[model samples]
Target chain A: MITFGKGNLRVPKWSKRVFMVAAGCSPFRKYFPEYKLEELVMMGYKMMLEDNNLKLSPLEIKDSIQFAVYGQFADHFQDQLLCEAKIHDYLGLDPLYNVGIKTGGATGGTSILMGAQAIASGYANCCLVAGWERMDEVDTRTGNFYISTAACKDFETRMGRIYSSYYAPMANRFAWAYGLSDQVRAKIAIKNRHYATMNPNAQQPGDHTEEEVLSSRMSAYPLRFLECCAMTAGSASVLLCDEEMAYKLSDHPVEVFICGGSHTLRVADRRPMDIPLLPNEKPGMYDEFLKKNPRWPGFESFLAARFAAYLIYRMAGIKEPIEELDLVELHDAFTISDVQTYGDIGLRPYGQEVDYVESGDAYYGGKCPSNLSGGLLGTMHAVGATGIWQAAEVFWQLQNRYDYIHGDPKWWKRAGKKKPKNWKSLQVKDPKQGLWVSHAGVGSHVTVGILRKAW
Target chain B: MAKPAYEKAITTKYIGTPLKLHDEKPAWVIESPRAMTHIHTYGLLTPFFEGLTKGKLMATKCVNPKCPQGSTWLPPRADCPDCYERMKWVKVPSVGTIYSFTLVDYAGIGIEMKTPYWQIDVAIKGVDTIFKGYLESGKPEIGMKVKAKFRTEKPTHTILDVCWVPA
Candidate 1:
């Protein structure tokens, strides 16, 4: 098996501590026609600056911003190139110099990574990390085609033009390799969509049954429509700063530790390699299991996610992730991806991913409950904005303000929806730490971030 | 009423057709696209695509003695990823096991294949990477034996040019 070099395995370090003080997102929808893309961005940006009970005024916070990082996944969907310039000017942050980040579905997490880098490097004391996507302009099939282009055009894109077709193979292989059932995947869809009932910004929240999810029209066989995240339009943002600025902005600031890892864009190219161990894992822990399935990442797991978790667990000094993390927000772009990640991030060991969901640990009020934000499955897969929204949800949960942000009537009204009479809070009780995983392109890129409440 | 001279005389009249608005209530939303074209190139990997039409499954391998890995790759890259050196072309065995498979029932717009077909990732012999292709016939399951069936008669010149059938 191929092994990593010593230099390749060094844990990442930052010169300064980073914290996230505030996050905001526009109400997500399958088709948001009331506002332009810039307007949606302004809505989220304004919410971050004005709401969240920040100590500084919106104008003052705008004044304090030194640099900006923007994430927009596909120019083809938005039909506009250089969208960062338009969004930056619309937010009235002129001449502040902004950089655009693109990492497919991981753009939002990568944007935060960029913004945090500026803070950690002492480049900017306060930085803005914003992300947006406008996919309503295109029909669903066209949008799927646009997304599939993210796959390798020559060898893969045409084989199945939809992203689900790409992930479906992994789902099938995962089921074969580890005996994953369509039932387990359906349960994830049900749980996340049920959680979406509490999220005002959710796009496809539904109280679905396993029968409904399994019976839903097939995108690629065994992967029903309900199991996949649909195209959406929305925006989300977060403000990152150094330690001093974080405390100055809010009485409750969360410490941020984020790291990223990437694999080959095409799954066809992921060569056999040794499985990198997480902080809690021992050297030879996977030896017995590897005897049967020698392919390390094999179609069943995401190496990028495992590599990211390997780094962040060490950097943040996290050892038992399933117990230490109060809540988690997985990409959930597909149910199989979410289930596969249980092993990759050490929430569960490899081959036991199905048990993570079956044990009820992945549900509300369970140990390290996942996708409390409704996830990309039920909420918004507005591509670029998805990762940012996950962080926003985690930030709110960590601040103990899930009710104020999600249960309030104003937010429901703002989204042009009547608040359900029985809006139950999925808030983790007094959560101290939460983690969000932003993933892209069948495990090509993944970022695992932990937010610890520092109040 | 007049000749609208400035529109035509000074500049070409708006030759573009009026874009149809999908929504006009809270906001005007328009979805208009005439057409688009992208001139993509196979570049150095042209030989791999050409081999499909010639009924040959060609792969590239790293021959550098200093390289850590020297395995052949289908969907071949012109350069070896480990050594960062030019690779040499070589014919490979077309038979492989089905490492994985997916039945694509729904596809994106302009998909070349018909809907509800078996798409398979084959673990070809001697190739370090699994090659993605479609199964022209037979049900696909892990460990199912399959052999390459090239479109030697009429070529699409795409990855579609090569498919697999139960051996």
Candidate 2:
């Protein structure tokens, strides 16, 4: 967290040891009928304290916290801007500084980055980053409207492009370019659900067969209902601290570093269209414009994610991500996004993600185990909390603290008679490094973070 | 067999018997009065809208000789994004091709169109930016020729004044 305060003061290079000491998540469900937003936040905070083995009371812990950051997707409650302040008061935390973040689905990861910056800049010894969304209370029609706020108001919204609709064209183009088959998409859906069954926190933690996924009602042309993320109610929190404080707090701290992030042009700006010429130009003006401004890779889709991943890999000193990183957790809002992201993140070549998916290299115990936490597909998508959940999963995996669930024949029977080929052990023997990527606002805002286990 | 402690607690709290499982629904439906309002001074885009009323599509072009971005923008901006200089409006040809499109299976809020409508990004002739609109008729296809069908009789002074049709 670089302190963008007065003078834009920079933290000393030596004090750049930011570590994730503790992480907690509320049980993901379709709806939290028993609790409200503030209560859910408090529950997550308490769980984080418990996970860190801090037996101190809420007030005691609050006094030690120097700063806090909160992330929420939509206003489940009436007060939108003051939600973070309300949560701070509800938790009885007297942090020196606190702020709220609303970056569509990327809020969780962005909040984590802010927390790390706060600790790294010596502004706070410990910072609490939390994200939650109570979406189940809203009807489908209302929810669609709120989610569409992430798109461009003047162009996308006015043109009647909703959240799912934005991805529809991307899916269409990808299928048209790569000849993406239904079998490949169904496989991706089944793989995520299969991993979800192993996760107790998963909202839809049941095995889904290929036939079930293929037969699911289509939401968009290429995206089906089962292939989409479930609207969920949950909260997640992570505690970040300086290097010295991290060692004193936890035996195994996952050292996290924000590699890089970028915001891309709007969908209208980068669409595959020729540049209009000036009135005076001759017949060769359009061709001249093309020469000066060649078409870029992001013109198709996932532009920001591609740009962010390139910077991240470069910052982490990783020349080859597929061979270097132990695991990756992507924001798979739609199954097509997962397929597109694999190539965007440089795990595989563009348009060759179908080969990677068909090869079973993305599953657990494969070449590159991705979304072992079931991703957004298997794990419930609380919108704002998803990015934080992805980071927490990496933290747990790095420390080997997560509950390891092996292949079970009984669970397979419940999801229909389909079993994964290599379900031997979903656990990574020793993961040194992992990456977490998330996006918001129609692929405009993207944030990628790299986590390395500090021995 | 005796009921589990957790089950007994839940049943006792609600009623003597266990609570019935049912599909979850919101307690109340909120009809939100949502409206997207923009106060445009028409500082630079006045002529662009005026062109639409006359059944003409227009864009802004940077007159600076050395300016990048090819001195052109669709849905024109006040200044050139690259050179940051004032731009002049120019008439764009109505005939274009579909750059990309999506069939809206579900209509969104504030959208007056019926379901199963075609929303397209039409690349106007000689224009760098794609103009977004719905096709007047016929299914959308990539690279398919399309021409602007403006509501010249009753101009709305909005982007909706024009629709795309097969050329």
Candidate 3:
């Protein structure tokens, strides 16, 4: 049994407050041969410097940066090592110390966490966090194999040479244990893909019906092709600053609260333990849940996500997440993964995750809409870029520029696509706070970050 | 006179095949093929894989009394995570109940088994953790009883050596 000591229970406290000033990302696609990896990173980097309405000039901001952090998931995919040095030098920020962060799919969020820590620790007044993945370097199956190796090579990777097979068993167990249905799973795909229709950066946008999702090609039993995010080639970036540098950088700066948690690499090795309570939950709230589910985070749930949420909610001092957070950008790598986070993050109590979507809380114009940027399911899952893109989406929404960023014809032209005449604005009205979950390797590493509007 | 004349002068040539161009549309994308074999050691867990080929399932158990959990591990670990103590190998029952299952229709590159196979996670009584294996030939469901079937004749010597069949 894994028990948290008093030291472990202590919430993370920053030496100084951290703030996010700007965010940017390139249009995502399954294959991007038009630009080299460095050039693609430049595309997003330039957007962050120029487009976010920062007070300082792009070069002035560059001159102000004290350090940089890059997140790239796998060297096998890149076929090159020390990509940070190349990217750092390419960005014209030579001689500035930079480090690379890798935590599977959570690399992006972890990079941001590192950047935020630099600001929080007074190590840097201004820090740059950028992440990217070029999955098109290999064919789809080879890419999947590389990703699957992230699973425990000895135990799990040999069982199913694909990642979806890893999640499909969980889906089966969850459906059996919680009385969840295939219909509920299909709805998520339809919703996220439909939401993708509005995203210029979305790689796969469609107005798919429930039938279409249900009838799609099966990757694993009960999980169709559309239920999973495809490999993407793109990059995303965000800038973090200390409190003093925040107002100097932008008229709209967002306060950042982020913390991470990790569990065993093998899902089978997860020992049952007490569900760490969120700030709003009570001591015995999950007692009945424990009695029913037995294993608190069995194949059905993620302890890493739960643990991260447990710490972040307390660190951010959020009492009721469903009520407090205005909008959310979840790591919807898979539909089930998206739904599973609802309970883990206290969006719903343990047994009522489906109700979050059923109750319309996860939809646009709902109580707390999620994945308003179409999420990983719709837009992209350039593994390392995903979490940064999620944060950028929330940052833009909090800035009330969702329409300008996502709805403008200029962005459409940049992506080489015509803006749809029926494009709908997914802007959450004047948002105060939002949260995003960056997860990796069957809930191996997860970071829950909250971005509160601080103008 | 400076050099005592090397037995064979160092000579190298481009014996490697030219890497094929993957795509040449906007940017010249070249295919860089990587073929490698990792020297993996089972180490203390060698007995577990070796036992699979011998029609036995070996698990590692922590016998320390001070340890909070005296758990047995399949995909047996050398040390107990709870107390950081070395665990001893023990034989576990080869039968288990299906806790969960899935049919993998399409898989990644380098998949050994044939497609549309049932992969099951089996929960043995003594083992604290569920073990994953493929069902040999049968439909799978939760709570279905299954027993281990090893590949003894021509052992793959991998985890694939041990599979499950309907009990």
Candidate 4:
């Protein structure tokens, strides 16, 4: 088990390497009314090029990353991989090794975690972790069509499954099984959107009311548009290097300590011992999979939070109830996801999330501040890049410079407190450890990483 | 242009003897490039919805059968993820009600259908039951009642062939 930290490094370090990075932002419904998947990929590439003079054609970039991670948004894995491979070639990074893709909705964070592990494990001296998706640009019908393919192609996609339909059953099960009220889920949306307002980069940033959430067009029963994650076109990338190299690359660097990752191919397949389900197993798994049985607290945010807690216990060597963590960044792919995430992290008791939101206890300075820098619900998914984006947010917060860079004055004003110099900067006065969690696959794959401030 | 003799009867036959046999194989093998509506395939990892031939949509149930109810998956699976045990194929009822829906006005790559298509959320029996498919009927309204139609053109029984129709 390799251990990592901020200073007194045990591992050999390189210089001027990426300590923290991500692709870019793309929030659908917020970025534009319509865009294509291909266009979104170009947008992310453009951002990468702006910072670095990596001269390469779209095709080159696609091909270069072919061996890399693939998201649900791509038309063909080969096409996306080759397109990225070409870009890497242009960037002058060759022989991208163990090229493979991992899928979890908002899976970008996990990719970064994997990339960080690869770097830490000495698989590669330096590696780029990227997540991109053209959600807005792609045909909604086609995009959802692909999502259908990802979820359960034959039954869902060929049967003409609606995009939100993929989550509805799960969402319903979350509500019913957890004994959660619809109103609580609505409040989750309100709170996350409010958090998004603090993020300038967010796709749909604004304050929302419970009424607005309830009134939003219903995507699925008990799940309004506000409660769901709006699709977007965006990408994120994080460049990782050895500890020594990361320190040398930039004066300000964020180190990653991977606690552990547990991703399940099928979420419903494994039931954790601690979490309880309301009803007993139904006769047919297919029937349960198809019906609107609600999975209580069924959201990406909650899963990320739970996984983070699990990681915290693993890293801290404590199995006590998870209320000790100070901060978190989860894949709030949807408002409901964020709401359930609150409870999943044990920040609030199940079904009491509305009270938590009403108390304003789930904010940056709350008992356990969640999605302080915005989330997929607020920032924009960028398809594959979501996980990495979540990781980057945590990195920014650890630096304690988020407010300074993003600048959400309203958050401070609402708290009736003085504003900090930088919200993205780490605020750990004598910090020792921090935790990060991200999940994809419609809340199927949950991973957690624990990081220390480094000696 | 002169109309062909089968113009009136030219509707796509989703259910038939040959179509039923088609469910045993992958759609790629049976579908003409023109008939191919999907651009990608997820293989066994995702539920194929091809099992409608046997009148069942398969799903993976959480094998920790000891855990609370509702931990199971639908469409049936080969193994239980929670217990890591073999899964049992369970048949589901075809009845469902609309949970949500959308009208897509654009087409995508590999999707030959024109815009203004109706996508629906049709409820299936059992916990957390719901599946998607083209709505071949009047404008979709919430609370609309529909039943699952098994398609035969599916190349395998594991493929999802059900479509929701007004009851």
Highest DockQ among the candidates is held by which one?
A: 3
**Ten contiguous residues with the weakest lDDT in model 4 chain A:** A273-282
Candidate 1 docks with a DockQ of 0.68
TM-score of 4: 0.62
Q: Per-candidate TM vs. native?
A: 0.98, 0.82, 0.98, 0.62
- Name the better of 2 and 4 by lDDT: 2
Tens digits of per-residue lDDT, candidate 3, A1-455, equal 47887888788999999999999999999999899899889999999999999999999999999999899999988888999899899999999999999999999999999999999989999999999999998999999899999999988887878999988988999888888898898888888888899999999999998888989999999889999999999999999999889999899999999999998888888877888888888998788888888977889888899889988988998999999999999988888888888999999998889999999999999999999888888999998888999999999999999999999899999999999999999999999999999999999999999999997
State the lDDT of candidate 4 residue by residue for A177-219, as single tens digits. 4455777766666666666665655676557887888888765
Candidate 4 deviant stretches above 4 angstroms: A1-73, A76-81, A95-100, A158-160, A177-179, A250-252, A259-309, A316-323, A348-359, A408-434, B1-74, B77-167
Q: DockQ, in order, for the candidates?
A: 0.68, 0.19, 0.78, 0.11
Local accuracy of candidate 3 as per-residue lDDT tens digits, B37-59? 99988888899999988999999
**What stretches of model 1 exceed 4 Å from their correct place?**
B1-12
Candidate achieving higher TM-score, 1 or 2: 1
The DockQ-derived docking category for candidate 3 is medium
Model 4's DockQ? 0.11
Q: Model 1, B46-116: lDDT tens per residue?
A: 88889889989999999999989997888899988788999999999989999998999999999888889
Candidate 4 lDDT by residue in tens digits, B57-96 = 5555554547334344554556553445665555566676
| DockQ of prediction 2 | 0.19
Tens digit per residue, CA lDDT, model 2, B29-72: 33334346668666568777777788888888878888745546
Among residues 3 or more apart in sequence or in different chains, the pairs in candidate 3 whose N, CA or C atoms overlap within 3 Å are none
lDDT of 1 by residue, A1-455 (tens): 25689998888888999999999999999888889999999999988997899999999999999999999999998788899999999999999999999999999999999999999999999999999999988889988899999999999999989999899989999998899988999999999999998888899999999999999999997899999998999999999999999999999999999999999989988888889988778999899989978987978899999999999999999999988999999999999999999999999999899989999999998998999888999989988888888999999999999999999999999999999988998878999998999999989999999999998
